[model samples]
Structures are given as structure tokens and as C-alpha cells.
Target: MTSLDMTREALARAERESAMKSRILATVSHDIRTPLSGIAGMSHLLGQTRLTPEQANYLAGIGQSVQALSQLVDDLLDFSAIEAGRFKLHPRDDDLRQLIESVVEILAHRAHEKGIEIASWVAADVPGLLSFDPERLRQVLFNLVGNAVKFTNEGGVLVSASMVEGELEIRVRDTGPGMSVRGQERLFREFEQVGEEKSRIGGTGLGLAISRRIVLEAGGSIAVESELGVGSTFVVRVPVGQPSDFRLRQARATMLSSTHMLIIAPDGVCREALAAAVTSLGGTVRLAATPADLLASLEHAADAFTDIVVDRRLADFLSEELCKHPVFRNPATRRILLIDPETRSTTRFLGAGYDSWLVRPLRERSLVGVLQGRMKGIELRDPINDNRSNSRWTQAEGSGLDVLLAEDDPVNRLLLKTVLKKGGHRVSEVETLRDLIAAATQATGRPGAIVTDLSMPGGNGLDALSAIRDFERTNRLAEVPIIVVTGSAGSETRKAAIDAGATELFVKPADPAKLAELLASYAARRAG
Candidate 1:
């Protein structure tokens, strides 16, 4: 055979092999990721269970390892998809403000843990709604922000967006060791790392390459500006336009429309508490304790229900069944899964099907925000009661009382429990709402007060609080004080807790001394 023919044959063979490799990697990565996600999630859930300090640390390490594995698999798949031109933009109207804020909130904790500050600013003039695929935008932003936080040591990261010539220009800037000229050239090239030295950071090195492809596919361009030993700024520019639904929604804003919500769970306490919370926000909530109950509820008001929230486990069983149902056929209705943050397995399970997942420990504000974000037509009533504001109580300590507490966040929950227990009062602790309810109800003596986190697995603290109140009302015991502990403080949440018979609402990271004083006052009142 001629040399020219042999060279052509070799080139064709190489192209075919490359294509086959991409497909193999894609399939293997996808399959591996499904199980790996479950492993990572389960590890997280295991960490939340009762463990010794050492055991807890070990579980945390396992969780981190699984997360790293998941990221590696995801990067491999993303790179393969980009190379094959399978990565495409899926654009939809998105709330830019909400999208950016959510990303920042999700990443801020990790950045802070690394001693890096992450901040975001959105120009007020930015449209409330813009045409973009939020998922792709989020993925690109995640890559940029992740790299910034990973490389930075002592300095901070800033994310901000502004309008420029009918386009939105988003920037992620980091105070980290800058890249060299060669590094910049290889940054957006496939499978290229900054340095061959083992001392540098680790990654699949395809993130920036994939990010560039995603940005370009979305009708935008991405560029980087960096200085060695100074920092780096990655910018993305995408065209901005008012969303079609935004205009129609604005026109209909004057008309009062009632939104129907469905809460699917086996526990009555969680069902009732969520119902009350939704009701407080001017939404009518339908509680369904079982799949049969949910189907029945949907039958009665198939067209009326606008949103659905189900526990992750229950959602797993119902999603396929529910999707086949006539009620869920409507594309307008939103489906959300209420998930246990510690139960990473549940997260992976829910991720397979649900529109979104609401992490357990649902504060009133977050719940309201989620609902509002989903049901754009429903106007939320302000939950805060400014008319009854008490400046004196702002700094006043909580009433002193022997309390039974149920919470999942170890640091915050333990800190609060310690402060209350040290204040010459008895304090019993449990991790889940189910345990809290069982212990509180089965106790030989009544607790002077019950303190609980609003979100917990099995059920939320709000559920426990409602159950306690219902038991007291049914048994005719003297009204026991209850305090709702939450991470977010909003008037709406406070009102909902009070309406559900809670005595007070306490935000996390609250002053220990002030909480102790409040507990003392409440204890004195009960004694009196």
C-alpha cells in the first residue's frame, strides 16, 4: 500500500477510537455516578445518626471522599458530552436574582470553611426574569466559583452581575494565586492543567473547557483575566430579554388568585404544621397521608392544585405513579421533594425525578420562598407583625424552663442545648422529630417547655410542637410553653408557629445569655 493511503487509514482509525472512548467513558461515568451519589448521600445521613465524636469525624471523612468521587465522575461525563457536541443549552425563563442567590447560599458555607469569603451582588436594575437555562448557568457558575474557592487560601471571592448593552455580564473574581501565561492558554483547552507539579490543586481539568462550551451554546462568550500571585476574574456575557410569562404575570397581578398546595406525608404532625405554615402565607394546603389519600385529594381538585411537596421516601414511590395520574399531567403544577439533609441517599433518590428538593429543617421564610418561586401567581402575605414589635424583647433572654429539644444540626443544636441545660434547668435532647414526639408524649412528667428545630427527618420540629399542643388540648393539661427554633427569622414563620400554639420563636445563633434569661422568665411563670 502507498504511504499516503497508510497515513489516511491511520488517521481514520484514530478518529474512530477516540469516538468509541468518549462513548465508553460517558456510559461508565453515568452508571458509576448513580450509585456513587447514593453512597455519598448515605454517608451524609449516617453522619447524622448517633455517633461518638471520633465516629462522627470518620463518617465526615467518608462523605467527603464520596463527594470527591462524584465530582470526578461528573466532570468526566461533562467533558465527554462537550466533546461529542451533546451538551446543549436548555433555556427557560429564570429569576436571575433568585438563581444567583441560591448558588451563593449553597457555596458560601464551603468557601467560609476554607477561610475564604464569598460574596455576591446583583444590580437592582437587572430584570426580575430573564431568558436562560438556570441549570446550565448554575453549572457554569459552580465551576467558576468552585475553582476560585479551591485555589484561594487567605483572600475572598466575589460574584456579581450587571447589565451591559442589553446583555448580562456575570463575573466571578477570586483573590488567589494567579495563573501563568501558559496556564491561561491551556485553561480552556481540554484535559489541560496549569502545572505538572504535584503540589498544585487537583481537578479533572475539563471544567473550564466545558464551561466555555456551555456559555457559547447559550449565545454567550466567556473570558478570563488573571495576574500571577494576584487573582483571577472569569466573566460570562449572555443576552438579556424580558421573559414572556413575566409580562403576562404582571398583567394578572391585580387579580386575586388562590393557589392550592399538596403536602404528602404519613405523619399527621408534619402534615398539620405544613398546612398551617402554607395557610399563613395565604395558600390553601391539602394534606395527604398516603398515596391513596393523595390520589383522592387530586381527584377532587385536579385543576386547582398548583404545587406539591412530599417527603423524599414517599416521593420516590409516588413520582412515577403520580406522573401517570391525570392531575399531574398538567405541566403548570410544580413538584418538590422535602428532603433530609443528613440523608444523602434521599437526596440522590429525589434528584432522579423531583423538580427541586427542599432540605429538611424548613424555616418559614425558606418554605415561603420556595412556594413563591414555584407558584409565581400566588402573592404571599407578610408574616411579620410589625404592629406588635417589642423593642425591649429584642435583647431579652428567653423564659427559663426545663425543655425537651429535638434538632439535627449538631453544632447549633448542641450549643443551644448546653446553654439551656447549664441554666439550672433540665434539658433532654433527641435528633429526630419522631423521637421528640414519642418521648414528649410518653414521658411520665410534662416538660416545662419544648424547643425544636422546624425541619427534621421523620418529621419537623413544627410537627412535634403541633402534636404536643394537640395532646395537651385533648388531655386538658395546662398549656405548656413551646419554642420553635429556626435558622431564618421572618415574621411569617413566627406567626405560623404562634398560630400552631408555640409560645415563642427563636432564631439560631441567638445569644445564649439572652435565651437563658427568657427561659428563666418562662419557668417562673409556669411555677407561679
Candidate 2:
């Protein structure tokens, strides 16, 4: 055969092999991840319980492992995208500090086990919002910090971010055994783990390599500085920008100067942060370091402070104290609580003593809105209070969703039903395509959402999906959000499900938290 013909044939084979590999990986990932969803979902539910510190720690470990596994699958998918030159960048205004904090918080569990502190600091001059692909940035941080925690056996990982001349410079420094000059040369090469240290620390070794690619794709430079025993630092510099109208937040914050707020928080960092958030509101802020100081301040004229925000440390213990305190009992005194999502249940404090609670790490807008609304005497449309759909995922008992679930396996069906029911959804279980048809065509009111499995005894999920679409068109029925979940994973099956009218498709091991969020969004949209 001619050289060109042979080369063409080889290229064709490589393409075919790549396609098959992608298909196989997708199926395997679905099979593996389907069960992980249950593990993650149940773990989340378990975390909500009043467990001991030991039990909570154990649950946290499980969560970290699951998260790590999820990231592995994501990395594989991303690698494929890069190879195919199909990696799409979606840039929008994102809070860079929040993104950095989220990365650190998620990996904090693993670091804690090794006695390594994950600390992060964003420069004071950094913009409140910057345009970037949050997912890609998250991927980069996840890989870099995750590796930092793995290789480091000593002090910790410190993430320092600053904007210099319109470029975001992020440095991930770790007090671990560092790589040599020769090792640094091959560090960012695909699947290359330089040292024996990396060998002992388990990873696919695609992390740093993938991170480098992501940085380069974002028009950024990623470089490393290291010595044999002095630990290593990964440096990344990317363009930082914001949307055209960046002053709207500042404009709103300008109005807070007329409002007086007494801010109380426990940790010095959090206290300063919360105080800064209040200051951004253009308000007069008096920060109290302790509950005692807050109480002393409250002892003054009730009107002295238009608003009082207690720390998470004080919210739960103050219900009775609030009733007894004359200043607190006054209806004009607006009280807000800075709360932890996992530890402090916001519902318990809301209406108990607090006017509203913002979940930590606190968002400036939420703080400003509560303070401003109170100042204007404009009744706050509490997202939770005004709309059940807003809190449906966390507080699902009142969502009132009529849900249709189709699954052939009794165990899977029961699991789905239990989760949906617990999530305040009225689920109608059907095991076959015939049953799905019956449920869809019946004269009764249609469900708010439908969950279906792809493969079943009576017919496949796509068959049921097609039937639902036809029925919707024939009867001019309202489009209900349909989620297709199946163990059978393939491009054809996925495309078919989408074409036949599935709103979302998830492979098994799909996190229930994600499903809950999706359902909540749909419910909120429909309600609105």
C-alpha cells in the first residue's frame, strides 16, 4: 500500500478506537456512578442527622472519597474534550474568592486527616466579580490543591490570589517534599508522574497535566517553582475582567449608609468579613466581637441600631434570651443571623428570634437586601417564606410535586419513591412501558415531573419517552420536566432520550442533591 494510504488507514483506525473508548468509558462511568449517587445522597441525608463528632467525621471521609471519585470521572471527560479539541469555554461574571474558598473547603477533609491546614487569601484590591469559566477554574484548583494535600506531609497548602495589572495571579504553595529541576521539566506532560513520592500518592497523574492545558486554553500561564526538600508552588496567571455594568452592586451598597447595623461574629476573620459586607452596604457598622458586647450594645436605645446580626455561634442559644430582652423584642429591631448551612438550621432561628438568616460563607447581596428592606419598611419577600419552591431541596416537606416514576426493578423503584416522597413529591410508580403509557394518558392531572429508567421489561425508557412526547403533542398537554436515568449509556441512547423529550439525562450514581436542585428549579420556574 502507498504511504499516504497506509497513514490514512491508521488515522481512521485511531479515530474509531477513540470513539469506542469514549463509548466504553461513558457506560462504565454510568455503571460506577449510578451507585455512587445513592452513596452520596444517603451520605448527605445521614450528615443532616444529629450524629456524634466521630460519626460525622467518618461521614465526611466517605463524602470526600465520593467527591474524589466524581472528580476522577470529570477529569477523564475533560481530557477527552481536550483531545477532541471540543473543550468549550463558558465565561461569565463569577466571584473568584468564593470559587477559591469552595475549592479549599471541599478538600479540607483530606487535608485535616494529614494535619495540613488549607488556607486561602484573596487580595483586597481584587474585583468583586471577574469573568471566567468557573468550572474550569474549579478543575484547576481541585487538581492543584488536591495534589498539594496528597504530597504534603508537613505544614499545609496556602492559596494566595491577587490581581496584578488586570491579570489574576493564583499561587498554590505547599510545604511538601518538592520536585527536582529535571522532574519539573516533565511535570505538565500528559499522565507523567515524576517522582517515587507521586507513585506512593495515588492518582491518575492527569491532574497537573490537565490543569496546564486548562490554563493554556484560558490564555493563562501555569508554571512551577520548587526545590528537592523545600516544597513546591504552582503559579497561574489569567486575565481578569467583569461584566460591562459592574457598578450596580456598588450602587446598591451606597444606599446602606443611612442604616445602622450591629454586627456580631465569633471568628476574627469572619467578623471582619461580615463587617466589610455590611460596610459595602454603605451602612454605619458597629462590630461586636462577642455576644456580651452585642448585648451591651443592644442595651442602648433600641433605635440606636436599626439592625442586629448575631453570629452563628449565638443564633440557636438566643431564642429565649431574645424573648426576654426588651430591645430584641421590639418589632422595629430587625435581626439577621450569619449561619452555617450544615450546622445551624436556619428554619429554627427564622421567626424564632431572627428576622432572616444568610448561609455562610456570607453573600454581600443577601446581607444588604435584608438590611435595606428593613430600613425602607418594605416587607422582605423572603425567598424561603414567599416561595416553597426556593427551599424545596433543603425543606422538601411542602414542595407539593406530583411526580411520576418508571423503573422495572422493584428495589430501584422503591429507592426512587422513598427519596421523592421524602423530598415532598407524590410519586406514581410504574414498572413497564404500558404502565408509563397508562399513567401519561390517563384523564387525571399530569405530574409536575417524570423520572424514567431507559431499559425495562415492557419496553425501553426511550419508548416511554416517545410515548409521553406523542401524548403531550396530541392532547396539547403542558410540558412536564422529564428526567431520564439509565444504566445503559451510549451516545445513541442519550441523543434518543433528548430527541424524544427528556429534560435531563443522568447516568446512575447521579447525586440526589443534584436531582433535588434540578427539581426545585423546575418547580420554582413553574410556580413563578
The parts of candidate 1 lying over 4 Å away from their true place are: 1-19, 195-201, 244-528
Q: What is the TM-score of each candidate against the true structure?
A: 0.45, 0.67
By lDDT, who's the top model here?
Answer: 2
> Model 2 has how many clashing residue pairs?
8
Best-matching candidate per TM-score: 2
Residue 136, candidate 2: C-alpha displacement in angstroms: 2.4
Model 2 Cα lDDT, one tens digit per residue, 1-528: 999999999999998888877767766776676576667656756665577777866876787678777767766766776776666677889998789877776666566567555556555456778999997899899888888888888777877777677799999888788999999999998877876753545467788888988889889999999998889999999986655544664564466777888876654435655665556556667766655776777676445678878876766565566677777776887888765434435566675777776655444445566776733212222221011122335645657578889877665566677667766777888888888878877657878899888766677667778888888888887878899877644445667889989989876655565777787677778779
Q: How does residue 22 of candidate 1 score in lDDT? A: 78
The sequence of per-residue lDDT tens digits that candidate 1 reaches over residues 458-490 is: 775566678988888788777777777664333
- Pairs clashing in candidate 2? 33-508, 33-509, 34-508, 34-509, 37-509, 256-282, 257-282, 454-461
- State model 1's lDDT: 0.66
Error of 1 at 416 (Å): 33
Alpha carbon lDDT of residue 512, candidate 2? 61
